[model samples]
Target: MGREAVIVGVGDLPLNGGRIVGGGSILQVQARAAKAALDDARIPMSDVDGLLVAGLWGVPGPGLLPSVTLGEYLGIHPRFADSTNIGGAAFEAHVAHAAMAIEMGYCDVALIVYGSNQKSERSRTLGGRPPILTMQFENVWGIPQPVGGYALAARRHMHEFGTTEEQLAEIAVATRGWAALNPAATMRDPITIDDVMNSTPISDPLKLLDCCLVTDGAGAIVMTTADNARAHGSTITHIRGYGEAHTHWSIGAMPDLARLTAAEMASRRAFEMAGITHDAIDLVECYDSFTITVLMTLEALGFCKPGEGGAFVSGQRTAPGGEFPMNTNGGGLSYCHPGMYGIFLLIEAVRQLRGEAGARQVQNVETALVHGTGGTLSSGATVILANN
Candidate 1:
């Protein structure tokens, strides 16, 4: 009964002006999203026997007991519960954890969810961290929080490779192109590389358009045995392969400024487990905390040789009608990025595999690559999904 783990349902809320349309606390919206995912699978909430959740909603008590609090709020006691937080990559890692739990006969149906009210609550800030161990080294420099870290990577990549600012802009412009087709995306207006170049510079070569959207968003995914999903006649995406790794919490500790070693290692392991080649991949959905994030990830994931991402992403290759389709849901760059963006990446991959993405749907999609990066290029998780 537990031969394979497949995702049968996913739910992501709408966004207006890059923020959730309705205001609600993190748990409230997360609960609704959970209900929506369960309903989509034609499974009642009572059927959920496992839960995997991650969030920044609770600080002290609930934060420490994230899964416990979510369980209490949902009014369900699960036989299997996990609250593994690896930053934005946490949700992708959760998928792997749930797959093992389901296959091990610990839980039949598992739910993974994420919700954030940062935008609505105006709680988005890099200023709250207490200056301690790692902070002791970084906090004093006054380097711009996450953006500065990513900018360092971008600058190093440029120095190592012949990558150009125009090449980096191509990612932003292409992502926006897909966002234009996505009604749920916050920034839908068409943008050009020139527009990106002209936008206010945030950190060195990174511009205002290079950063991700700050929005309040919630999403959920439901996974279960393949037999269970087939019995319910639910279209499903196979959780064929997954792997996660992290190298550094702070930028100073990153192994190489020119490359994301964690992404390379994680994707290599996932690809080995799936036995899939680069040509077999139909779509790529990776984290886009910044335009550089996407560019660097593509290179790290072996889609192209290292130091070749800028060239790989140029010419709108990742946009619609291009040879490579990526961030079809606009990604965190244009889509709603509620702190942790990995959950939405999973949902979009499922939707695309199910052929549910109306306009942005790719033809003959059988395999999709979903990757997430958390912290300041601190962690990476890769999941390979198949609709076979």
Candidate 2:
């Protein structure tokens, strides 16, 4: 048998919308989250010999931040650590890397963590310009912020295969249904197809509600070898398969907006690793920074054929108690979007596998597929998780 890495524990801070947290800085939040995860696994902090931290985008200085800062704060230093920033895919990649480290005998226990202050930061303003290093030429020509970029992709899908505005609205409506069950969700009011249709328009085809929530949050995941998982009495959710790929960072350079190449490649590799097909997956946590994101990912992952996402999501297909359960934690659309949207996908996936989600839980979620996209649909990372 090949070397294996398992997620032993997971924890997340409450997603608060009204007020932002200022006392706890990024490092403090991350430390707290990491500690919580370790506690959940019933392991002491001193047992961690490896640490992986998600990179921060808004930091103005040297850019990259390693696990050292949080390590020093938490008083648990590890010899092996990685601080990676591939856009929003950082956390998912960290989890995968932790698995590889344990498999290679480089470490016994690892902590994967992320934290952000998107709400308190002024740079998050809609009119605020991204840093020079973060800016893309595509946005210079009034391409309409992130909303416009995704809207353009959605419009192309409509023109090519009769995809309709109503179809896109279906994603928003269904996600809101999930949000109603999550008290942490920012938008809890039930919405209808008409509500999404008549809502204020941000871009040509995208409405205001079509976008994800803006909030501040932190999350952490604990990884260890299979043997360590069992020895430590941790709730084990094995990483059966995972894949990552990227095309271009800019939307203008994309050959086809409707089809996501990186997502397809990553999903294919992940499915092969897990030795399972789409039918075996009881839950799916597809990143949804925007409504179109979920639609594009659904098609890319073979959940539906190209151009069939809009129709596939209709009739509450992805809603609670639906045929194909998805985004049960309300997702980025209604749950929270703290710039690191991909990290939330990882959080929700682990929560489902642990059967910790009470009201929004799905039945028999023994296996799950999580896909993350970063930048302007530039990078993709897919992880297949199984419990049993």
Best by TM-score: 1
Compose the digit string of candidate 1's lDDT tens values, residues 192-234: 9999999998889899999998888999999999889989887
The collision pairs in model 1 are: none
Candidate RMSDs in Å, in order, are: 1.1, 2.1
1-388 per-residue lDDT for model 2 (tens digits): 6557898888777756622344366667777778788899888899999988765533564334557666777788797798876667767777778888889989888988887766755336543456365465654677666677788888888888888888888888889899898887877889998998898988888898888877777888888877878888888897989988888766776669888888998899988888888899899998888888889999999999998888899898988778988888888888888777787788788888888887898878899999998766777899989888
Estimated TM-score for each candidate: 0.98, 0.94
Top candidate by lDDT: 1
How big is the positional error of residue 263 in model 1, measured in Å on the Cα after superposition?
0.7
Q: Residue 375 of candidate 2: its Cα lDDT?
A: 69
- The C-alpha stretches of model 1 lying farther than 4 A from their native spots are none
